[model samples]
Target: MKGHTIGELRIGQSASFTKTISEHDVYTFAGVTGDLNPAHIDEVYAKGTQFRGRIAHGMLSAGLISAVIGMQLPGPGTIYVGQELSFRAPVRIGDTITATVTVEQLDPGRNRAVLRTVCTDQDGTCVVDGTTRIMPPKE
Candidate 1:
């Protein structure tokens, strides 16, 4: 599960992880993070909103991107330094989400990697798009 070291990374290196948003997942995320927004937790309340239904927390979907950075691309020991994200669409329960991270730049002297991060629903619609900076593990 070791991640690529700074020197080993390259532009275009990529990785991905996929997950289905489930009722249990949404509930647990809400409970754990204490983000009790009705749009994410209350179906009845959500129906009146613009989304017209419950949507998973944007961060929950972002966490999928984190999963890829921590466990797949740069893998274990990666230190997430910064991220900038845009939530493009609602993620409803039962939607399968795929998170992908691709290396866009590598700065070996500073031991950093800049990656293009994205999460797409089953329909291939981008739900989240962002850039992440990380310090890859030093071997």
Candidate 2:
């Protein structure tokens, strides 16, 4: 995606992208965040948990929304100010999840935008929902 400016955005507009959840991503996120929870890394251990198999971390799936904003929309030099998230479903290895962001509100004076974000699996099941606040560069 190309870079964009704050003036380029319009309220109610949206952008979306998809990514496959891999075992490697889960393990790497565990290593990076030190969240070595069995549910995310151990299939055997996870089978005994409520998830019934290895599942990605809630934050890991949520992070895809950040990737969308930082790399796709309002990309490069965008400053994140806040986020609100709700985990709705478990993201399993091999699932193809799509992350979407819609411009909800824009504060032109502050160069900030409020976006409604969501991550959904291949079956159109919502895995995560949230709002993100970001200041896309003026120039």
Looking at candidate 2, the ten consecutive residues that score lowest on lDDT are 1-10
| Root mean square deviation (Cα) for candidate 1 | 0.6
In model 2, the Cα lDDT at residue 86 comes to 98
Backbone clashes, each candidate = 0, 0
The list of candidate 1 runs beyond 4 A from truth reads: none
What digit string (tens of lDDT, one per residue) describes model 2 on residues 14-107? 8788999998999899999999999888779989998789899999888889888888787777778999999999999999999999999998
Assess candidate 1 and give its lDDT: 0.96
- Alpha-carbon lDDT of model 2: 0.89
State the number of backbone clashes in model 1: 0
My TM-score estimates for the predictions, one after another, are 0.98, 0.95
Each prediction's whole-model lDDT (CA): 0.96, 0.89
In the range 15-81, model 1's lDDT, one tens digit per residue, is 9999999999999999999999999999899999999999999999999999999998899999999
